[model samples]
Target: MLKTIMLALAAWFAMAGGGGLAQAKGLAPLAPVAPVAACADLARIDLSGATGAPTRQEAKSVTEAGAKPYCQVSGTIAPAIRFEVRLPLDGWTQRYLQTGCGGLCGNLRIDAGKAEGCAPVTDGSIVLASTDMGHQGMDTAWGNDPQKRRDFAERGVHVTALAAKALIKAFYGRDPRYSYFSGCSDGGREALIEAQRYPQDFDGIAAGAPALNFTIQNSFHHGWLAKVNTGADGKPVLLAADMAPLHKAALAACDGNDGLVDGQITDPRTCRVDPAVTLCKGAYQPGKCLTAAKVEAARLIYQGARTAQGQPLEVGPLQPGSEMNWIGVFVPMNADGPIMSGMFASDTINHLLFTPNPATPYTPQTFPFTLDMVAQEQPARALYNADNPDLSGFAGRGGKLILWHGWGDPHISPINTIAYFDKVGEAMGAPTRDGFVRMFLFPGMGHCSGGDGPSEFPLLQGLMAWVESGEAPAVMVAHRAKPTHEGAPLPADGPMKPPPGATGMPKLPMMPMMPPQPTLPPRSRPVFAYPAVAHYKGTGSIDEAASFEARP
Candidate 1:
């Protein structure tokens, strides 16, 4: 109790005055406490409280190829919230990091996403924990159970944090100096829900492409994409081959709009792509042109979900530049199997989004895409959606939040993330929001990482700097092995020379031939804070991060 009170006081001072101001307030920094018990003894530690009791299954030493040596403790919170806690054997930094899970999230994943440059993670100086969100599989079958659903919604993370902290204290004899949460995609949803529902759980949070506005996104947005691509005969209107041409066309129209012809639309919102560009003047040619049906399908998808009266049902449509990602997701690769959006929409509607009514399993085709459908989502939204912008509790405690989304995200539209950020500014007041909250939209990046853009950035490192030192990130440098999507490796032996009679231009310059410039494997670029994008300075190589500057 004394220790808890002392830690709370320290946190309060830290929040109130940051570093030097806390000293001016006459408060000394809290000293670290050494381990009071053995690692294995944590198995018997009591974590019972208002939430419930935890059942320990295993507590032992763990050492993997890439990971540092640590004590791996496995346990379950009340009603089967399976969790794992990793305590560093040495170089403990008095910090706790909890990672969120992706998709249905039934398996434990201890990875902190995009942790480059984060000292605690890179140096293996922090305690880490993760959970399966109370279930055992990557499906929505467990949603039928009310307690499990509740656990998956919010309780699981909170309980896991509590258990991890209790175990941390038992082994280290004191609470961590700071706690942080990081996640992307559905895990991003989990991160936001944690901040909204349980503010004190972490001092800093980094949510990437978070699935906020859950009920509408899962039902209306995902469902609309699936249903729109299906023809009257229940066949896919657009195939994988059909999607390439549209993306190619979109690129041709807007790739250079940002003053750089770098195969990526920096801000897709400003780019308007007309589907007619890909429309077949005559009969359809697979990768060159699209038939009217396919063109209409692409147009409708970019137009987004709408009611019969034409009112928009979603935050916004998938941006113009993201059309290529629709191949395996919105459009089908073949004539038959389910697309990605259909699978997710079906799972959500049939099991998780609505109260379990196993008798009536809903699919994209079966679910009604209307305002009534939106109204019916209130119950699930209360538990699932983290759209509430009132993050006063979190901000009040000096918690720092970093919300990032890929501008070219195919699954969840970046517009949704922008909408939420706008709401936060409105709810908390722009000044207050600016103090603790920051949003970064990575151009050409997909859901979490992979896309045409340089999605890899130091998210954890930036969040830590903000939380620990009050240093807000003005811009983040991102990188990719191959700078642009146009990069395709040549033959291993050597660059292929075209036949002498070939009509097309050669890969190398025909006149004034000189050695080709060395291709830099990893290309670095900058992504600025929200509403600001990286603009090329025109004189320097666009591939280099230093050549670009942040502009609103």
Candidate 2:
């Protein structure tokens, strides 16, 4: 009887074109399996009069374990926003993921979905998508086009999500069960924009190190740092070598305050070290001591960006452990001019916010850090900043938001994220806010990832478990990557003896002695939600998360 039923169902599927057939002649209706689209057929999928058109589509077979074949579609949406989507050919998990891009977002990066070890499409289980955020490359010339600027600020990601979902439906014959957005830095800004401007676009969002106050951060703050570091002769007061002593002084003063001498400062807000401590008492020494001007510059950076009236700006001070990373911003390639931050500020101010024209010549010297300058940029701020405190619409619809920031982040201050989280809590009330929103502050982590501390964690899994099973993460474990020595051996003066056990005909030469690897800190730590601290338990291996407890 079972065999006969199977045969009848197969016959019905064949006749019904893989669709359910209504009961007839007293035979019960048979459910049908949805037809899956072939990889190549996805290329022919029409998106005209839709969100975007697919310019290229190809299928590739992945060799990763448990991975299935998938289709990759790349194209441009309205206003020339470039995008790409990857859909699994089999074993669809009924989930869709939209990844965010970083650092001006001129190039497409689909792998942002797997940032910090969160892999949603590991086995072709989830559809993954990414966009170039409207423009291509680091050049902000596209800002001259209002439509492109609008796309770069927010529309690009939203349209990409819509177009991706439409493709998912056309290829799978079903809508996704869930949709998520994940990103860091500018990508994080995009995630917040989705929550604020288009709540319905995603069910869960994981944002890390978001550059929310985009206009102000990239403009005034950048100019302020450059101005403070510039000497009387218009040269950089602080050189790259001066950072080591500053970092050492900071660590020496604050590293043990957390009841552990690990490299991480734990909470830099509590650190009160004076930068003047590194100032030279006598002659100027290159690496061992900082000049008076350089010391003042470092102090200004740590004191945070301030207005002429001495009022604190939106951007926070650099954390104690972020000195090493500051080299990239404070040190110029040559004696003549601006560093990375200065160049970014000059480009943004001249091309994007202030003039929005490439023909207008503007340099770092042209931009001034003043209240008037800040006032002039308000219009662009409104267009770019994602600092909205309200998430009621998102929460009411059962959306989950996971915000994480690296305390050691150098580009955008982590305190900005904390301030934003606090604002959201105040606006929505703690009880209601905690229901759908959580923030994680990773100690010693830098930018999106990588630092002297544990940074890797499966954020996607945490979001899914919270959204699907209502299992909110009380503490997420972040892993510190082990150090590697994969490159060529260090230079040596002459050949050295081989290993004792070696029986080669000729003695093998040994490379120069390499410096001892720095002792790694804790391998993993518990990352708790905002307002809760991860305290040491005082027992067991400090490297393990088991030795930490969450406390308010």
TM-score of each: 0.86, 0.83
The whole-model C-alpha lDDT of candidate 1 against the native structure comes to 0.76
- Give the best candidate by lDDT: 1
For candidate 1, write residues 1-552 as lDDT tens digits: 223323433464467564211111221133434567777887777677624774554688777677778888888777788888889877677889999876666666576768876767876778998888888754568988988888888888888998889888878978899899998877888889988989999999998888887788888998999988989998888887786789888899899898889878988877889998899999889878999988898888999999879999999999977765565566666677456687778888888877646477787878887889888888999988889899999998999999998877778898988899889998878888888888888877776875667878888877887787766665678886342222321110111233353222134311111112235456678776766677887777777886875565
For each candidate, what is the lDDT?
A: 0.76, 0.72
Please give the lDDT score at residue 62 for candidate 1. 76
Report the C-alpha lDDT of model 2 over 162-272, residue by residue, as the tens digit: 888878888889888889999888889999999999999999999888889999888767767777888778788877678778888889999888888877788899898
Pairs that clash in candidate 1:
none
Clashing pairs in 2: none
Model 1 scores a TM of 0.86
| Alpha-carbon deviation at 79 in model 2, angstroms | 2.4
Off by over 4 Å in 1: 1-34, 356-359, 481-521
Clashing residue pairs in all predictions, respectively, total 0, 0
